[model samples]
Target: MTNKLTVKIWRGKEQGDFVSYEVPRLASQTVLDVVTYVQRNLEPSLGYRFACRVGMCGSCAMTVNGVARWTCRTHVSKVVGEGQLEIAPLANLPVVKDLVTDMSEFFDKWARAKGSFKGKRTRADDFEPVKPDSRERKAADAGVECIGCGVCYASCDVVSSRPDYLGPAALNRAWTLVNDVRDTQQRERLRAVAGDAGCHACHTQGSCTVHCPKQISPTAGIAGLKRVVGRAAVRGRL
Candidate 1:
């Protein structure tokens, strides 16, 4: 793969155009590798975000060829066609620079979803015994490895349409705590995730689930929240 790969990347904000760059192709290189090459060798002005470079951080996500992917893990061979690649910022977010996007809206939704754990116990108190095999712990464990990247948020169609929507990642985080027997904010959390702008807004399209680099199904977890909230509301507990 020594041929020069033609890379088309979106420059600036929504008002910018796609600029082309002929990046030298290498065997077994990832999409991030190409971006790094261009930044280090071809264009130092190019902007993008990356940290672990090993797919764990999820900071290197970009629209590779048209799909949201962790560039650190996406292989060039998997996405390239005729030595050409179209790279762009993650969808559903304001592009700050080339491949970088502002994540404020995405994180704000976490607050809106009441995703934080509100515990009643202090550090001085004895450790809370949680059964690993218990239903609550099992459900919480199902989607606890989220890295807080905006990939799922960017991949969601409902989020693109509704800025007020809580989106999948935040709702999934709420679900993890929703089933936690130790969390004291259960009722309030349920209320936060109820109604049109919360869990009910999810179309269940599964784009968030499909694009999640951590393999966490936020859609499934959000659905669980919806059911829990619906049941509680019916019981007059919400």
Candidate 2:
């Protein structure tokens, strides 16, 4: 309810420190609005990335008050404790500059997890009939809505400790693909996600599930992956 809010924003690359800024407070103002004000009115050189201002793009996500959140959807009134805000880049990723982060490694692990779909049928083939209510379909439906916002990845502690570990998003995607009956590369996908750097590396700490803006539970998906991958390995299918 104050006229202005004290915001501390991170200002450099890998090695950076928080810099304080005073931003005018408005009703229902979002954290993205604060960062934008700092950039457009106070400091033109400030760097950040945002595509769709609405919640769909998930590009406006950042760490607000030590939690990963979609800045566009986060209301200042909800998180600005003590009339102050602390903004930082998403954790566990390489910081590019200012508020932007390098997502190369994040997507790289997606490929390493074999997250892409591979089917035996050609485009000429008729659409494969899929049962929506079936167990696999239901399971796959739960995790297919990911927009690669990296919130879950940023929230995951495993990614912070073991850099080689495949983060929650990629593993969750792999679980989705693995459950798809239309996908024929289950064996390879299982193989790709089996080792320490893959599904097995997850600590199941649930940080990803807790912070996901989409309400998707990557922890549950990773659990399902563990079961399937373990069965595959035991059956010599991995």
Candidate 3:
């Protein structure tokens, strides 16, 4: 391990390039720590986004050496190669500036996939009893922990190939809702995720599953969506 690391950081919006800087290496340093040092000590004008540096927020994700990762949890010793680091905004999204990529499109796709749960119960209705061990509940439990991190979206190769694709995170959310017995919009949600730009568009390359920091298998969710949608299509319900 060297005393200094060559840090090359993206310096502008979508049209800019990488700018090099020398950052003093420290013990147990994370990639976010390195970026913070550059912004605070070397270049005060540098722009980036981070909250809850402990990795709970999932807002500190960025592309490091061509791979999307949570910078806060990425140790410097693990990523530094030849005492060098390359940091940039997450891919497949519009860059706001420096390490901040515009997340509007990512969330927009979530909406398009009907990611939100719609229930039939009103405020005055009695509480619905749900069994934790039921199959539906088990399926829902498999994917209910998504944090909207966008790491899977950034790592999905299908999104890069087909810009209109709804992407993995949105489809994953829809899958969870599909298994929610309380959710009244299963048919509509299935319709939303079924067409050319939806679940069928996924080639199942599994990059989204491979890169998700949360270990959420979006590929599995997509496969479930495919089975549901295919059944609906066969029955002329889709």
> What are the lDDT scores of the predictions, listed in order?
0.91, 0.93, 0.93
TM-score of each: 0.97, 0.98, 0.97
* Candidate 1: tens digits of C-alpha lDDT, residues 126-212: 989899999999999999999888889988999889988989989999999988899998888899999689999999999999989
By lDDT: ranked, best first: 2, 3, 1
List the candidate 2 regions with Cα displacement exceeding 4 Å. none
**Model 2: residue 77 alpha-carbon error in angstroms:** 0.7
Error (Å) of candidate 1 at residue 194 is: 0.1
Which stretches of candidate 3 lie above 4 Å from their native place? none
lDDT of 2: 0.93
Spell out the clash pairs found in candidate 2.
Answer: none
TM-score of 2: 0.98
**Per-residue error (Å), model 3, residue 98:** 0.7
Clash tally, candidates in order:
0, 0, 0
Worst 10 residues of 3 by lDDT: 1-10
Error of 2 at 28 (Å): 0.8
Instruction: Give the residue spans of candidate 1 off by over 4 A.
Output: none
